[model samples]
Target: MNVFYEEAGTFKVGAILADNNTSLQIEAVHGKRSKIKASAVLFRFDTPPLAEFMGHVQKIAEELDPNFLWECCAQEIEFASDALATDYFGHTPNPVEAAATLLLLQNAPMYFYKKGHGRYKAAPPDALKAALAGQERKRLLAEQQARYVEQLNQFILPEEFKPSLSQLLYKPDKNSTEWKALEIVCTEKKLSAVKLMEKCGAIPSSHDYHFNQFIWEFFPEGTGFGELESQPAVENIVDLPHADAAAFSIDDASTTEIDDAFSVTPLSFGSFRIGIHIAAPALGIPPESALDQLAATRLSTVYLPGNKITMLPDGVITRFTLAEQAICPVVSLYLEVSDDYTVTGIESRIELIKITANLRHNELEQHFNDDALSKGHLQHALSKELTFLWNFACKLEKLRGKSNDTNNDKIDYSFEINDEHVSIIERRRGSPIDKVVSELMIYVNTEWGRQLTDAGITGIFRSQMNGKVKMSTSPAPHQGLGVSQYAWSSSPMRRYVDLINQRQLIALLRNEPPPYSRDSNNLLIAMRDFETAYGIYGEFQRSMERYWCLRWLLQEKIQTINAQVIKENLVKLDHIPLVTRVASLPEIAPGAYVKLRLSEIDLLERTFHAEFLQKQDS
Candidate 1:
């Protein structure tokens, strides 16, 4: 006898090999033997051959309409399949008809829900309607996904992907239909999402692509001060004592956030009092204020070629920056030095000072440089002051045991971008302009850090012992700088850590309770967050600088370039701060100059391939 049964949610017909009351041993139509429970059996039949049984059952089931079967049944009521078949066929049904009806009911789960062995119930109208709608929606989405895949495969971006292009490129949502289709196409084509999008003309500018990728990760809200209320008036603060001498600031031509300046006043006995005046934004931007919070979020000014995101707003910078012909508030550190360049006295004060001039390095370096110093005269109006400061700076450098070392004379490169053209200028690291400004700033930071420590006030200090530099709350020696302790309190207008340390120093000078205590959680949290953000920002800046270096190469259209080998296969290109590997480079020693043939520059990927041409004489 042939028995129809349900096993593993599937229907099958088998010939019974042995009959048991609770279980049956049977041989399937395919001659495969199996064991099934007797309760799973729907019905039994004979006379029809087993091979033709399933084909006949499928044909009969196909001929029956599931909607018609559901309409024929009482709504929300269960009944045996054999009884339903009998009622539908208008007579006592045979085994074939009953099995076909059961198969149809089993297949259409949305139309009929199975309750028990050979028992079923028609779905409620509301549930059936919702289920049908969902199925139709799925069908439409599948069709749409197919279309998206077809277009992407043909290097065409779909209109649906236009709105989410940045997100799909930078930070993709894996479950999104667009991203799913992209994944399918990417796997099939073996191309990255960026490359595929670029092939489809989705990315217009490679520069913006790289720039926006960083912006998406770091500044998702865009680099803008959003809806900041009117800042507190800085000009109306408490009256500050004015300094007795005119001060001048030296910075790059493009600088607007002038943070530090200097004044050299001569006294009797050929002794001079040199003032290191730092812009005091901490006076107006009190701790936990709105402006302070804004500064804290940014941590530091993000600088790159042709652009920058300032830590403070333009209005705040303008109010506090030591611009020419303006009296700006400052935290001054004055040093009394003798004619022998020995520092005899040191004092700190909070006062206002008139900025007499804002000297640009490009213009100032032309006059106040080594050639002019050797001649004992400079052509600029601040010639005497520059001469004195240069001498004093040399003395200070010698005192710190940081004399000029020719072996470590590295070149500093500055980038200027105008109308899609790039000019990379190289400056010597230990030039007179650099040394004078750097030594004085270092001395003031060291001095203020020492004072903060002596007064027992909590401040952030930077130390380098064992050649590894780090930020900490306590004071330690910075062996690299040859200073006992160093704190970054000079550029409060540009760095959050400097601003934080400035607040502590200002409070220490005023003999008031410091803003941050030794165990302040805010101080610790700010220190950690600033260090992380500062490093990430520096990396982004270097990446952008590298991007522009590649741009400059293309702009000039030069094929052969010069590079100095740093080690085997790695070299630093001349005239730009770019280091890359040349796979074709012959085994060569470090510090040897070689000519390289550049090819296959990819801006989107920020990479280039260089082939070694010939070694040049050093």
Candidate 2:
């Protein structure tokens, strides 16, 4: 028996050209019989294209009734030659279907073939039936989703593209607060659910983001925000301190708030006198104001893929951080430093420094081998400055490091996927400008810190003790910079504790009693608070970002990715528990050129694909 399988609607046959003997669609009804029987693999092809013919049926004996085979037959078909089509054209009552027809003839007595004389029954495995059903469901869902997206792309708002009505069926009403409110109003309107939701006059309360501008529409004339809108702009303004700080940039997330300004002058004995600018956010915009309160809530800017949510409004934070750049009045910390970066003495002074622009902005880093900031200009400058501040900060960092030495490394590195090429890049090399700026800030911050302590001034102080942060390191003496009483007192734009610290320093310089007593608001407590705030700030941003990034990593196309064992008993993707060496860098493993396998990657579910590269010892 011969069963020829070819792509549906094709003029030429593929299986025959491959020298396959088992199946052939030919002009002859049968091939020459072989004396000996043997096994061979032939005539197997992928499923016939749904839109194309299955192939022509030539010289069939008879057709089956109930027409299951014919109805299920492919959309198209072809015969070996045009002449053969004429001989068998519509001869039988109904032509035999593709597969079953061939099978029926094969099982029949070839010398006396008659399709009506025999019946075919197929009992496929139970698993195959279930698998086919699942595949069908998936196809249907995908088709629906694609259709929804297509319809939505049309008639979107001229200015903004919005989801289609069909797409909204899949969107949950709970997504926004405005939506929640709309649900209530819609239900009360007594209209059909679809009609109520589609009404134009009132947008959903779920759109809290546009609430202030839109709230009026929801209320009757007397109940709306008419009075608030009519109030004079001057009346809405509150009593606040003047902020003349340089505008905040989105690029600097460093410790320096750059609230105030300073200029260093060399003094005797290798000591240099320093100046400090205290940022006064509470002055121009009181902490009680709407903008300030909101900024406090966000605590820091958030960076998420495709979008970002800033802690403070761009108009305020970007323009009102405060510094010498705008000639804002500030209490400055003056101090003398030795060659080793040691502060011999500190003094408090008042200053009107010129601020150039907002310096406290988002942090920018170059990817390995990618430089946009003048080739390590920033990194180099920062390094030199830190090196110069060695006298002051290096000592503090070592003490902290000594306390933190027992901690293990937190970061692991890699670059590869399933033998696909991805190269490893090196850390940044900073520029001279970076070093100078970094050193200047360190010097200024340390000087003021000592003057406040010496002047009996006290306020909230922050300490990241070496042994305190155990997951990464225990809070002990911080080794990042060396100092016995190393603490943060630099930036006030974002940090509440830093603000309080600056206030205390301001008091000392003004010869006024410090507003806070150390006994009441010590640095240790401030550290805890700072840590809490940092965690909260990071939670909304980095923590979620990591989850998404990991998800992307899992769905990457490379079959194998360079991986390193960073920990033991890491969880495998699919929530399937597995144990393996942590962060085992695959490329650096015992051998080279070994094949690897990607077990799984589920981005929607946020999981890592556990790969098995080298085989176990045989």
Candidate 3:
């Protein structure tokens, strides 16, 4: 006798070899033998062979429609498969027909649900319709994703992706169909998604990609000072006394936050009073004000190759910046120096100073360099003052016991962008123009740090020990700067830390209580947040500079380049601030120059491929 039975959720036909009361030894249709419980047997029949019976049931099951069967069944009721099969055929169903009916119901789980052995229940009409709709939606999405992949494989961007290009490039949802198609095509084509998209002309400008990614992460709301009401003009700003000396600032031509300026007044015999005036924004932006909160959150201005997001609003910066001919409110530091350039006395006060000129580094460096100073004459407007400050800066450097040897002799590259074209200008470190500005800023910062400590007030300081620089509320020596105590108070309009330090200094000078206490939570939090944000901003700037460097290479379109090996396989490209690794570098010593054949410049990934050519003999 052949028995059609369900075993472990699978239906099969087998021949009974040994009959027992509780169990039976049976051989399956393929002749394999097994023992099954009597309760597992659904029905037994004769005449038909086990294999033939199984084949007949499969054929019948294929002819059955699950939807038609579900519609025929009565809702809110359970019925046995054999009874349903008999009712459909208008007579008792054979073993094949009964098993075929069970198979159809089992395969269509969404249409019919199993209640027990040989029993079934039809799904509610509404639930079944919703499930069908979801399945259809998934099918349509699969079709769309296939189309996207097809287009991408042919190096064509689909029209649907244009709306979400930024999202697809920078931050993509992994579970999304667009990302899945992109991932598949990228792998198949052996290229990154960014490179593939660029090839399809989706990325109009690689520079925009880098910039927008930064803005998306750091300034999600966008880089605009929109609808924020500007604060009223600073009170008593013009009522302050106009100092006797005329001051001039030295900065890059593009600089807008003109923070620090200088003046030198000659005295009898060999004494002189040198004034270092800083733009005073802290007086206008009180702590916890709207502008103050904005600055605090940003911590510092975000600087890139050709653009910046100022920490303060444009109106506030213009009001406080020490522009030419403006009697600006300033925090002045006056130093009394002897003929030997030794600072005998120092004074700090709030005053008004007329900014006579805003010196551009491009113009000033030509006239105020070491060659010009040694000649003892410059025909420019600030020639005498510049010469005196250079001499005084040299003396100040000597007083710190810091030699020029500590200076890195490294090159500092500045980027200038106009009409999407980039020009990287190289400036030597430790130049006369750099020293004059750096030394005086250091002096003022050190003196103000000392003043804060003497007056028992708290200020944020930049300290270094064992070459590790950090920010802290407590005063510590900046070993690198060769200063006993260093507080950044020069660029209040640009840096939030400097703004806070300026407030403390102003309070100390006015004999008022300081805003941030020694162990204030706000002070510690600001230091922590500022350090993190500053590092992020610095990294972003370097990345953008690197991006522009790569663009410059492509713009110039010279395939052959020269690089000096810094170590092993890593080298710095000559004339540009780009460092990369050369896999083909053949075990060369550091500082050896090697010619390279450039290929495969990828701006999206900020990478390039280089092959080492013959080394050049110096």
What does the lDDT read for residue 567 in candidate 1? 95
Q: Residue-wise lDDT of candidate 1 within 381-426, one digit each (tens)?
A: 9988888899999998998898965623999999999988999999
Residue 52 shift from truth in candidate 2, angstroms: 62
lDDT of candidate 3?
0.89
Candidate 2: C-alpha lDDT: 0.39
Q: Please state every model's RMSD to the true fold in angstroms.
A: 2.9, 21.3, 2.8
Clash pairs, model 1 backbone: none
Residue 538 lDDT in candidate 3: 97
Tell me the tens digit of each residue's lDDT in model 3 across 208-248: 88889988888888877665446553554555777999999
C-alpha TM-scores of all predictions: 0.91, 0.43, 0.92
Q: Write the per-residue lDDT of candidate 2 for residues 1-618, one digit (tens) a residue.
A: 222332222212222222334433332123333221112221333344322223433333245322333333222342221112223244322222343344433433211122221222222335435655776777775665444333323311211114432223234446433334334445556543334443442224322212222122221232222333232211211332333322212123332334544445556776665455555544444433454444444344444333344444444444435532455545555556677656677655444445554433123233211343335433532333223332343344343343243222222222222332223222222222232344445545555555555665654433345545321111123334444343355556656555556656656655767655645533445445456657755554443344444534444455554333323424222221122332433433332222245545432223444545653331
Model 3: residues >4 Å from true position, as ranges? 1-59, 71-79, 124-126, 229-239, 406-408
TM-score of 3: 0.92
Model 2 residue-pair collision total: 88
Pairs with backbone N, CA or C atoms under 3 Å apart (clashes), candidate 3: none
